[model samples]
Target: MLIKVCLNGGRLRRDHPAVPLTPAELAADAAACVAVGAGAVHMHPRDADGNETLAPTEIAAAVAAVRAACPGTPVGVSTGVWISDGDPDARWHTVSTWGSLPAADRPDFASVNVGEPGFTALAELLLELGVAVEPGVWSTDDAEHLAESGVAARCLRILVEIIGVPADLAPSLAERILTRLDDLGVEGERLLHGEEAATWPMVEMAARLGLATRIGLEDTVSGPGGVNVPNNSALVRLAARMGA
Candidate 1:
């Protein structure tokens, strides 16, 4: 199973002291995670004010830095709806512009949330640019929706993101999602993860399911047994050990 590390999301330093916000911080943290057994890297690029942005320059810098640090490892970015204030056209414009970037500055793939506004068009645009897409599903409905959209086969993989739940409930949530996907004939690699309290449990469940999983400060701030994890690399190490 592939163990990817999400370096950071839209989280601020207050969320986690070690969350990598800038390019240099991301590159160094990415290198550490890779060394500890991360198979890929996923991150959200931030602008000068430390806010998440889909600006080409920010994306280019973050991708370039992580590539330099981790070499051949796959690096992805989030195309979440928050980036465009729920405007599908704005999201399309931002991602379309990213396609124009020089190859060295582009992400290997990007995660597109299935329930978000303009998801289908954004996935189509990414495919048109030759960049891979990871369809992100947050619920069973999302899984059903992605299956019906006819773009499942075009993606690099499916990302089952568990959210807004207690840690103990994540496993059932994941099982329901996978079952729904199975029922709909959605076949391909699936990566599962969760946020905050649900993070480590979901990763552990994904491991037991023999599917790919991910971890990082973006996913959780705690380690195994709910210990406070110090950095992204530590989270990767925890997930790697769990997988083993």
Candidate 2:
């Protein structure tokens, strides 16, 4: 099992200027996260504009930067449809229409936002290209779909995103998520990340359950304890204690 922390990069600048977006900044942050016990990380690479992008050039730079600093820690990136809408395809073109880039330019793992048009096709392409899939099962309904479709076998990892209005009421949501995964017969290792302030609760739940967990600025800028988190490493340190 692996504990993954997110270095949201550019997205964090607006919400928290301290979030590192440049490769140099990312290298430093990656080292910090690894030191605190995160064996994996999810990243969002940004261009000079400070917006999300997965362009192979940017991807290679970001991946290389993280690896240079963190050594063997696994790196994952977003292929989210919302990245730019592509062209005439709008919401559908994202992963499907993205022009090809070599494997070295790609992250080891990428997400399949379940139900996103062309996501399954992208997953197939990613698999063929030697990239691992980390499907993002956002809601309970998404998990149920995976259960029925035997989708777990198609990916390298499963990322259960605890999302809701009130959101991630701790072990309550975590227990519910786990039970659903159980029902689905999801046998492999999985990680949990929550939307907004829900991130900490999911980490706590994962710790109690002895499952791999996650933390990130994308999930919450605040500390798990409600203090202002200076960086992702701070979040990882807090989460690691739970596992200890």
Candidate 3:
């Protein structure tokens, strides 16, 4: 199974001391996670203030640094609307600037949430920019939306991201979304993951289903036993032990 390490999401230093917020820090964390069995990297590039940003410079620096640290390991970034204050147009503009980045500095792929406004346009732009699009499907509705949009077939993979659900219920929720995608003929590689309380359960579920899964401070701050995890590498190590 492919276990991608999400170095950070919108997390701050207050959330975890080890959350990598700088280009060098992200590089170090990516190297450590890859050493511990993480096969790929997903991260949210942050500005100097530690807030997520879609700025081309920040994105280029983050992607370049991580790729340097873990050569040949795929590196991906988030295009979540929250980074653009929920303004799809602003997000589009920032992402459009990524085309100016040199090929080596650009992300290998980027996650674009299907539920967000202008998701289709964002995905199209990323495709045109020579970046693979990973469609993030948060619910059955998003799965149906992805299927209807005809973009699922072009995505690097579908991210079955289960968030805001209880751990016990998350696996079943993920199942429903997966079933919906399957029924709609949305077939390809699928990566399953969850946030907060649902993280570990979904990780185990993904392993059981033989699907790709991800882990890191982006998904949770704790290990499978609910203990506070020290860093992204620790989470990847534990997930690796679980056969992720």
On the 0 to 100 scale, the lDDT of residue 76 in model 1 is 93
Q: Please write out the lDDT profile of model 1 over residues 87-166, one tens digit for every residue.
A: 88998998889867998898999999999978888999999887899999999889888988889988898999998889
Per-model TM-score versus the true fold: 0.97, 0.88, 0.98
What local lDDT score does residue 198 receive in model 2, on the 0 to 100 scale?
Answer: 76
lDDT of each: 0.90, 0.73, 0.93
In order of TM-score, best first, we have 3, 1, 2
Sorted on lDDT, highest at the top, how do the candidates line up? 3, 1, 2
Write candidate 2's Cα lDDT for 63-99 as tens digits: 8888778777788887777675543244334443334
True lDDT of residue 193, candidate 1: 89
Root-mean-square deviation per candidate: 1.0, 2.7, 0.8
| Candidate 3 residue spans exceeding 4 A from truth | none
Lowest lDDT block of 10, candidate 3: 235-244
- Runs of candidate 2 exceeding 4 Å displacement: 86-102, 148-151, 167-170
Query: Candidate 1 vs candidate 2: which has greater TM-score?
Result: 1
Question: Candidate 3, TM-score vs. the true structure?
Answer: 0.98
